[model samples]
Target: MFSKACEYGIRAMIYIGQQSADFGRRVGLKDIAAEIDSPEAFTAKVLQGLVRQQLVTSVKGPTGGFELTPEQLRTVTLKQIVVAIDGPDILQGCALGLPQCSAKQPCPMHFQFLPIRDQLNELLRTHTIGELAGKVHDGLAFLKR
Candidate 1:
């Protein structure tokens, strides 16, 4: 349901958050890409978007890399990341990809998909990167195959 970049962005965020929260360290691009099993170039681009959105911080120097502040780890929701990389439309766009789908001029599946979309939006809005990172940190969830 998410673009490849968005998928990688979410994974990168979780990994970065995990490292920052659990290990007290920032993660370099190479490490973030390796942990998430994504290409460095693509992950760098995705990270650029997150940095642009102020969802993640990027530092430059000998020991510089990427990290989320404790406040960001706790407060940055999946919805924010999704919207940052994929735009807010992903949460509200038609499931069938119809450009004009809506309540008044509903697509065939619009009414049926409304509740599901709402539930997804709620999940994204409430679920934080910290929560998912914690799951990974505790081995309750896996980011890689």
Candidate 2:
């Protein structure tokens, strides 16, 4: 349902948030990529988009890296990250790839997919980075295979 970049972005955010909240440390791109099992270059691009959106903060120096403030970890929702990397259309796009798939012009799968899409949107809106990170930090979830 999500692009590779979006998937990686979500993983990267969760990992970064986990480190920042649990360990109280910033994460470098190389470490973030390794933890999420993504390529450094691609992760860099994804992180750049996130930084551009002000969803992630990038610092430069000997001890500098990437991190989210405590407020950001608590407030940044999955929907925000999705929209930042994949744009808002990913959540609203037609399941059948039709240009016009609204209720007025329903696609073949429109009705069947409506409930699923709404549920996904709600999940994204309600779950924050901190929540997911906590699950990982507590070993209740895994970011890697």
Candidate 3:
């Protein structure tokens, strides 16, 4: 599972991508938070990380906000967003919150959780934001009600 920040980051990215790919519009933190049903302050903080990672672009003043380039939309995977917000902990951390769990000193759930983690990593790596945005554009997926 992802942290609240990571969840907001993914939703923000997909929503921003949809705006770019479907409407050619830039998005503000308020708009994004509203669309994703996230708090504005928290969304802004999450987006700050994406901006720092160069995953999303931001600007100031009226008519200036955030947007992603076509190249970014096509290449920025959910894994990248996760790493940007949560680091590699989600993929490598112990399922039961054991800090020292590893193959040599395995926890009870370690073996059981490894394959599921691997599959999740693969799915996140392979799926780009563009694909998710395309789903939104086609009315196949949504970020909020």
Which one wins on lDDT?
Answer: 1
Give per-residue CA lDDT, model 3, range 1-145, as digits (tens): 7899999899999999999988888998889999999999999999998999999889888998899999999999999999999999888899998999999999999999999999999999999999999999999998987
TM-scores, in order shown?
A: 0.97, 0.97, 0.95
Candidate 3, TM-score vs. the true structure? 0.95
- The lDDT for every candidate, in the order shown, is 0.94, 0.94, 0.93
Better of 1 and 2 by lDDT: 1
lDDT of 1 by residue, 1-145 (tens): 9899999999999999999999889899999999999999999999999999999999999899999899999999999999998998879999788999989999999999999989999999999999999999899999998
CA deviation > 4 Å runs, candidate 3: none
* Candidate 2, position 85, lDDT: 83
TM-score of 1: 0.97
Clashing pairs in 3: none
Consecutive 10-residue window with the lowest summed lDDT within model 3: 56-65
Expressed as tens digits, the lDDT of each residue in 1-145 for candidate 2 is 8999999999999999999998889899999999999999999999999999999899999899999899999999999999998888768989987888899999989999999999999999999999999999899999998
